[model samples]
Structures are given as C-alpha cells and as structure tokens.
Target: MIPANFTYHKASSVQDAIALSQKLGEEAKYMSGGHSLLPMMKLRFATPEHIIDISKIDGLSYIKEEGEILRIGALTTQSEMEYNTLLRRDYPIFMDAIKLTADPSVRNAGTIGGNIAHGDAANDQPALMLAMRATIIAEGTEGQKVIPIDDFFHGFYMTALEPSDVLVEIQLPKKKKGSGGAYHKVERKVGDYATAGVAVHVVLDDSGICQEIGIGLTNVSAAPMRLDRGEAVLKGKKITDDLIAQVGTIASEDSEPTSDLRGSEAYKRSILNTITQRMIRLAIERAQH
Candidate 1:
C-alpha cells in the first residue's frame, strides 16, 4: 500500500524540529532513520500530512560521558551502540539488547530515539532502557524536560511525547565496579522480536546477596514490565538455583501474555520464566569477574 501524500520539511536544529512539530501538531511526524515510521506509513497504519526529517540535525548524533551518566544522542544508530567499545566495556547490556534488534542494515540506520519513540511492545530497546533506569530528554516549544523511561511508553505504539515534543537524547547511569548486565531473547527468527525475552542488571555485594536488580520483560504485556516481585525474591539472598527458580516463577506470574503467531499465553509465560532465570545467571557470572 502507498502512504498518503505528504509534505516534507528538513530540520537543521533542535529548535527547528520542535517548532515544526508544534506547528504541524498531530498531522506531523519526525523522521530519523525511517526504519520505524516508513514501514508504518507503507502499511497505512500511520499517515501524516508532514514529515520533518531530523536526520541532518547534526548535533543529535553523539556518544559522550558526562560525570556519572553515559549520554547518547537521539540520532545515534543502533550499530554505533552495538559496536561502541566504551559501551561494551562499561555497559554490556546495552550492546546485548541492540544485537537482538532487526539486522545489520536496520541497525546501521535505526536511531535509538526512533526505536524508543516507536513504542512497539515487541521492540527490544525499550525494555532494556526501562531496566537500566534511563532518562529520556525531550524538547518542545516550552523548552526541555526529562521523563523516566518507565513513564515514557504509554501503550503499544503510543508514548508520552506530545505533538510538539522531540525526543532529544537518552542518558544512562554509568556502570559501577561490581555490576553485571545481560539481555537474552527467544526470537522465532534471527531478526524477529522476542517471543519472550529478559534484560537484567544485577549488582552483588561481597556476600553474594543481590544488592540491586532490574528485570525488564518483553512481549509479555502492553508495556515493558519491571518485575518487582522477581527482584524481591533475590534481594539479600544468594542467587542459587532455588532462588532463580522462585524468581523466574514470580516473573512469569507477573506477565500478561496474549496468544498470536508467537505461541499461547501459557507457552510464552513458561519461556519467560526460563529466560529470566538464564539472564540473571549470566549477569551474575559477568559480575563475579
């Protein structure tokens, strides 16, 4: 299907993008790599009268460390994140998650902001961002504000971004000395979204008790779910097989799966339990040495 006829605008600066979005209102859309929006337009799932291309908005593509935060500009491509040595050394979970999204072509072109702004529950990055407690910066006519990753995605294909807002950057807390992170997925095919997946960040004290835990489950609900019960089961306790088994069950029980081409809700739930446990174990191993 052909997308509805639309006009195009090129934004040379952050202010320009914000102003264009504000002026176009609900009928306008922002384009980065076009991986997320173009497909939707082709499918007629979304139609906009105007597309303001932010791809040439030069300053939005960068990776930098600011004090304790690792700042990633909105236009940073997935491939850049996937191959960034600093990111891999300091935050392996970020790399682990991007490796599971689409293919090399898509990764090379798709922007981190585009993926998060797309808000598809099946998209891998949102779950990872949620687990990492990342902050999203958005600029609008009123100036800039930050939103918690947990509150960013309102629902499937929906977000908290207003028509006038342009997501500017994503900032993640830097990795500490004794932390471990991993992201694991059970995809039907190489580039397919996870049938059930988990992204975990764990910090262990000297006693092997879980000091901090973040579990983000994908394709289990309308939004990425941070499993509190699952984390509660591991806090101040050894990550033994018994603990993993118990927490895995807690994670599974917290999921809200629906049947589709992926599998039945029961099947997805069972797989989520296993994946969650595996990801946490990987995180533990990475943390240990």
Candidate 2:
C-alpha cells in the first residue's frame, strides 16, 4: 500500500529537528531509522504531512561512558549496541534482548532511540530499558528534560515525548558489580515479536538474599510492564524454588495479555511464568559469580 504523499526535510541538528516539528505541528513526524513510522505510514495507520529526517544529524550516534553513567545516543542502532565492545563487556542483557529484536537487516537500520520513541509494547528494548532503569533525554522548544524509564511510557504506542520534542539519548547507571542480567523471549518465528518476553536484573548480597531485582515483561500488557509483584516477592529474600514459583504465579496473574495470532492470554501468561522462572535462575547464577 502506498502511503499518503508527504514532504521531507533533512535535519542537520537536534534543534533543527525540533524546530521543524514545531513549525509543522502535529502533522510532522521526526524520523530516525523509519522502521516504525514507515511501516505505519505504508499501512495508512499514520498519515503525517511531513517527515523531518534526523538520521543525518551527526553526534547522535555514539555510545560512551560518562562518570558513573553509560550514555547511548538515540540513533545508535541495535547492531551497534549488540556488538559494542564496552556494552558487550558490561551489559550482556542488552545483547540478549537485541538478539531477538529483529533480523540483521532490520537491526542494521533500526535505531535504539526509535525503539523506545515508538512506544510499541512488543518492542524488546523498552522492557530492557525499564529493567535496566534507563533514562531518556528529550529536547524540545522549551529545552531538554530527562524522563525516567518508569515515567517515559504512557500507553500503547504512546510516550512522554511531545510533538516538538526529539528523543536524543538514553543513559543508565553503569552496570553494578555482582549484578546478573538476562533476557528470555518466546516468539512464533525468527524476527517476530515475543508472544511473551522477560528481562531480569538481579543483585545478590553475600547471604544470597536478593538485594535488588528488576523484572520487565513484554507483549503482555498495554504497556511494557516493570513487574513490581515479582520484585516484591524476590527482593530481600533468598530465592527458593517455592519463591521462584510464587514469582511465576505473580507474573501469570499480573500480566494483561489478549488473545492474538501468536497466543491466547492464558498461553502467553503461561509462557511468561516459564520465562520468568528461567530468567530468575540465570540471573541468580550470574549474580553469584
């Protein structure tokens, strides 16, 4: 299906993108990789009058450590994040999550910023970002503001970004020592969105009690869920088989999946339980050594 005709503008800077968006109002969409908007446009789900291309804007495609934070430019591609030496050395969970994000063709073109900015519940990176407690940076006419991962997501295909704002960067605290992270996903086929996915980050004390834990669920709710129920169950307690089982039960009970071609709600919930259990175990192993 052909998309509606639209004007295109290549933005040379973040301010340029924001200014163009402000001028075009709600009818203009800022495009990075175009993986999300292009598809929606083709299907006629999105009909923007103009596309302000921000991909050519330099300095928005880097991964670097600043003080205690690891900062990633929004334009950083999934492939870059997957293969980055520092990221691979410190944040293996990112690699695990992006491994199933899409095929190489898509990964090469898709931007991490687009993944979060698109606000698609099924996108794997949002769950990972939530699990990692990342922060998103947005620039607009009013200036820049930081949005916590917990507050960035609003609803299905919705985010905190305004029409005049451009997501510029994502930052997270450096990976904690003695922390373990893992991502587990169940999909119908390669490159398909997860029917059920879970990303786990665990920090254990010397006594083996969970010091901190983050459980992020994907494709099981209107928004990617940061599972407080599971965290509440595990944190400050030694993880037992029974406790893990209870967390699994919490996951199954708390998820709000709908019946779809990939799965029924019951089936997806069941998969969530299984994935949660497996990820907890793996995360514990990683945390221990």
Q: How well is each residue in 43-118 modelled by candidate 2, as lDDT tens digits?
A: 9999999999999999999999989899999999988888899988888888888889889889999999999999
Best by TM-score: 2
Per-residue C-alpha lDDT of model 1 across residues 41-75, encoded as one tens digit per residue: 99988889999999889888888898989899999
Candidate 1 stretches greater than 4 Å from native: none
Report the lDDT of model 1 for residue 12. Answer: 95
lDDT of each: 0.87, 0.90
TM-score (C-alpha, index-matched) for candidate 2 = 0.97
List TM-scores for all candidates, in order. Answer: 0.96, 0.97
